[model samples]
Target: MVDLDPEYVAARGVLLDALEALADHREAIVLVGAQAVYLQTVPLPGYQPYTTDADLAINPSLLGPRPGLEEAMRRAGFRLKDEDTGHPEPGIWEARIRVAQRRDDLVVPVDLIVPEAVAPPGGRRGARLAGEHGRRAARRATGLEGALVDHSLIEVGALDEGDSRRTTVNVAGLAALLVAKLHKIGDRADRPDRLTDKDAGDVLRLFMSATSQDMTQRLIDLLEDARSAGATRAAIDRLDPLFGTPRSLGTQMAVRALAGVLDPATVQATCRTFAAQVLAALGGAG
Candidate 1:
């Protein structure tokens, strides 16, 4: 494993406190997004960084009409930003936080994304694919809440998915999730403001590294389906550049040569371009 940056460690403490509060009502928190990436217990391919945010999928039902979550966060030295969209009722509810302190102008960003869907039946809250690491992390967070916090209303481990088929099935289901999320962008265009450049960059890098030809082909087929279904060309175009024609095994290896010469800035730029292509293809399909 690669060494983690010190900044990641500092920001993690703040995020842990925040997650501990959410875990107070463990069953109500559905873990998803990048936060789940760290819980996967494996480093994301080559990227070497500690995650600093907690992402959850709340049933939306569990969140009261007035947003009281902000108070819980405030106790931990985290102030809810007025711009947060997750909970806008009372003080503030944020899915993203920037550390108040900075070292060398680096302010760590912790993101807590809430997806529209809750866990399917028998799925663990906030984590479906997370194996041992996720369980361990969740337990640690729960313990912290119990020992240090007074969250009487919160419940921990309300649901367990020891036998959840959705999780135990295999890689096929995991691949399908990528496909599903690829398709999901269309349904989300109504909120044009929701699309961020950083989000596009992450998707591009993930798609570039995490997928195989078989998966890419499946994605292409889906894009074609979306286009036939009347998706927009502009939307499809944004997501198209992230990909090229399917690669041969040898070509895939050859591409790594560029990684040596390409700087981080270049890699990010390339990923962004590729992600735009992916978005475009998805849009055209819809």
Candidate 2:
């Protein structure tokens, strides 16, 4: 595993705690967000800038009608974050845990999201969960429709040196991850200031996952079997204008994000080249 900061290690510890808390519903859980990408990228988690939150996309359909995810989480000491802080984000929940090397209980947030398909239509923008107790356990997330099917089961271990917790979880694969990242990126592309260097850097790290050639070939196979090809196709459509050249805004943002650990020019050149191979594997459709 990549060495993580003590804070991130605590985040992982909390994540493991949450996952284990929902152990009965593990198969129904699809790990998304940076942690999902981190799981697939393994030995190289990110562009040397580790992500902080653990995001999970749960399939309510697979979870039985009885006890729901919210109930399980609450049973494990998780509470609605907004309720505690008087904020309005109902989908966010947190738990306090005492870990070694930390003087106090760390409050780590676990973001619960679900495929938009499962969310009730007309969109108040939350999951169709009664939580078996009528609670807004998760929020509706776009581009996660394919994730319930486009993922791989992996054994995940805590990054904390003091935490020995481990469990098997389904993590979103490369194409699904790219699609999710692009979904978030595409939203902010028009407003470059809103585009986070973190998201751009994530795209580059994915491109940096395996050899460009190998990653492209694997991506092709993934797209072929993907449930919602449109999502990945839309992701591909965003790439050329975004990372088709070394100077593209997306590539530049990635360079900026990784500037802390890598040479800027090299990262820019590499992203452009990898972006080309990826697009080519899609028959240069965009």
Candidate 3:
């Protein structure tokens, strides 16, 4: 595995501290988004610095109202921010806490998302384009509240740091994470501004970390299951263009951010391999 940057370590420490504060809701929350990607990729080679936001998904059915959640986060040093403003908007609630004693005014964002049973279309065009089968698959993949309920708890941080604070939190399984990425990428057609290259990069990193055979089998299983659930071949076909399309502005920014740390060639190769696997898994339907 590649050595982790000190900044990444400190960022993770902040995230863990936040998670520790919400220990009462630990079981009800599953880590998703970029921070979750960081955790999943830590054991693998290559380094991708995490964004400021730490995303957590909750099952509203199990957790009930989120008013208490906001209060709990406020007590933990996070102040809620309005999503209409330029901030990290993961779902319904967005919050951030400035790191104490940091000269840069560096802040860590926390996004509390309630995975909806049915995800709204990316846009009017996306709604018309996706049709019923595509919408259902997107909903099934992104509605991870139930799918990720039984996530694994992993210890983060180490005993050597001065803080030596190692905290464990529930993380969505790789399969679920992959599905979520796919759903996000597919929805980009409607919300081009919101979709970033980091989504594509995360997918590449996840694919590279998984052994080819394992990824192939896992994706095949996932696709087969979705196919059985009335996800038509057309629904599967919609994802094809996302893989081959030009990089979005967000992706370009992400690449520039990691320019020195990650090899460009490796990133490209992993994307190509993943695209091939995706096509195969869908039986070359596209």
Candidate 4:
């Protein structure tokens, strides 16, 4: 609920309008990616110097199958970006929607992600929310109609400092997004191919930023166990860069262990030699 510029107000309106309109025929839509992160209040949502575009998750069935939806976005004033399809699986596709740019300290691009490649969240997590948060979000819920309803940018205003709802929205939103990311991982893994670097990086970024400390410790432990259990070299390689960088000692050790698996001979020899030197100075390998 950040206050937006007057000029960009109508642009945000238009983007909301399109999604609301699309939602009419679609079962459900969840905003995802950077926009979702910002909505979730991850430590660095708006921390980025500048960003363009908002990403949303929508079911393809809601869009009436393939290229028609892409044409729809074009009609709505979005310049769809065409990139080389990184994954060649039959059901994956993406369309980027850029509605407007704002002029403040820096220009930020607002993008709308068409949910083609990735599926939205499902089940009780997706079904409904609970407590005061559930009540408030429901009142604010645009359903499909609410999303289409226009409000002046000036009217939206900055989120009230006293309000707790923003945090609630962000926390719930982030939790759901993490589930989606995990799902995407499984989907890609089940295919003939492995998860892409982009997918892995996205998960790591979210994990470091949004997860609670206890959860973070658990992830570190899980990665350590995965390394010991003989996980794939690529998996261990991905975890290596996270260790000993500038974080906690526990994080450093986790990275060191994974690095060992990725380069066993070098890592083992170096670590063992280092350990032996220390042991000799004091007494042994215990």
Candidate 5:
């Protein structure tokens, strides 16, 4: 692993508090985004540093409206930030906190999401939770159903010295994380506003930090599971155009994200090799 950076430490600190706040509902929350990726990776020599907001997929059925979730988040130093979607109630909320007496406040965003497969069916952009006091409190996201099923407990804590709070939070398994990143890459192809090279870089990081055999097998296992099988199918379908070649858009995106920190040649080569290896292992099917 690389030396702990202050920014990453700050992000983890905020995440730690949120996890603790929702400790009772840990069963319903699965850590899903870049923060999860950063925690799981064993940094390579040229690992680029990137840590931001948190995303957690919740099983609303398990986190039923009672005792309230927003109240707990408010008690943990978070405030609700509605995205101005014109809904009378906004489902979005962001967690903010101070780490290590930093001069500026860290707006540690925690996006509470619901998998489209399990989210209450409606045309509303975000999912609703009665406990959040009529506000949506969660958004519906695709390809997250797999995350809810493919997760494991991880002991997590802040890196800031003297803050020794630790908790076992459920994070998406490697296979699921890879699948979600691929799903994001595919989903963003039409949404230029949300598309970024970061997700592609994240895919490369997963392939680079672990053995292809291990990753391939993990994905195969997920494919065998019912809850995540559809997501697995959708995820694998995106492999080729993304990383089939060094010149592929996904491969090039990964290379670009690491341009200054790693040799572009190394990033491109690794992405192509590993993407093909995983695809071959699964035979391009879920």
Candidate 6:
């Protein structure tokens, strides 16, 4: 078993605390982004360990009152961030919460991202959830129902093996995490400045860590499941171009973004192999 690093352990603790605080709204939330990646891959080899934030995709309809959510976070030791001046703003639907940990000076950020309006066809912009309509769109495209089945229940902050009070959080399924990562990387061509090296590196690590065979099977399974669950054909089609032969500009950007993560030769080989697997899976789906 892979050992959980101190940073991930602390982050998981914070995430668990947040989940416990929001237990009343658990059904409406789906953990996503880097934190979800960490949770799903923690037991696997080559799991990258650099994120200090937890991101959750929340249904706007269930978010209820902002004040109540804020109060819950505050009670769990998180302070709401009033402003974010960072480039490519987080948008209006996203909220950041910070907590001071006793072990270090680093403040952990937990981001709650409500799905905004769906982007136009072939748009490569960020996933910003606008209002209730956007939330519905997100649920449809992401096959939210499938996520509920593929999730793993993790017990956090347990004092002992039998600790009954240990908090449990439902992590996003691996397939959901994979789709989200691919979407982010696929959108890199449209927002190169905002899509940083970390994003590319994460995608690379995700592909490299899982064998092409395993990934191919997983994608096929996810696609089949999504289709059966009434996910839009458009949503499934969007993923095809990303796996196109010769690779798209976004794929190149992802490769270029991995300069220091791995040797150039290895990165190229891994990308090629992974892309081939994806294309094959797409063909099989067809």
Number of the top-ranking candidate, with lDDT as the measure: 5
Q: Candidate 6, overall lDDT?
A: 0.53
Off by over 4 Å in 6: 1-10, 42-48, 59-68, 83-107, 115-149, 156-166, 209-261
Ranking by lDDT: 5, 2, 3, 6, 1, 4
Q: Indicate the residue-level lDDT of 12 in model 5.
A: 78
Global lDDT of each candidate? 0.35, 0.74, 0.54, 0.33, 0.77, 0.53
Highest TM-score: which candidate? 5
Clashes of 2: 1
Give the per-residue lDDT of model 5 (tens digit) for 138-186.
6777887778777888887777786888888889888889889988888
Q: Determine the backbone clash count of candidate 6.
A: 4
Q: Candidate 2, overall lDDT?
A: 0.74
Ranking by TM-score: 5, 2, 3, 6, 1, 4
Expressed as tens digits, the lDDT of each residue in 166-270 for candidate 4 is 111111133334334444444454462564433333433445454343333323333244211122222223232322133422233323433423343433333
Give, for candidate 2, the lowest lDDT window spanning 10 residues: 42-51
lDDT, candidate 3, 54-141, per-residue tens = 6676543345333356556656666545434754223333334345455665555555654543334363211111222221111113
> Of 2 and 5, which scores higher on TM-score?
5
What value of lDDT does candidate 4 attain over all alpha carbons? 0.33
Q: Across residues 1-286, which tens digit of lDDT does each residue of candidate 2 receive?
A: 5555767777787788788877887777888888877677634324454665688887876776656777878888888777856664656778776666879877788988877656655447566574472447777777766677678889889876666778899888776787788788777878867888878877877887767666565556545654456566667788878888888878888888887677888788888888887777668532
Error of 5 at 242 (Å): 0.9
- The local lDDT score (0 to 100) that residue 146 gets in candidate 5 is 76
How do the predictions measure up, each by TM-score?
0.41, 0.85, 0.66, 0.35, 0.87, 0.62
lDDT of 2 at 109: 88
TM-score between model 5 and native:
0.87
Segments in model 3 whose C-alpha atoms lie over 4 Å from true places = 1-10, 42-46, 64-67, 83-104, 118-150, 158-160, 190-192, 216-238, 244-266, 282-286
Question: Model 6: per-residue lDDT, tens digit, 204-245?
Answer: 656755766676565566556532234323333544455333
Candidate number with the higher lDDT (3 or 5): 5
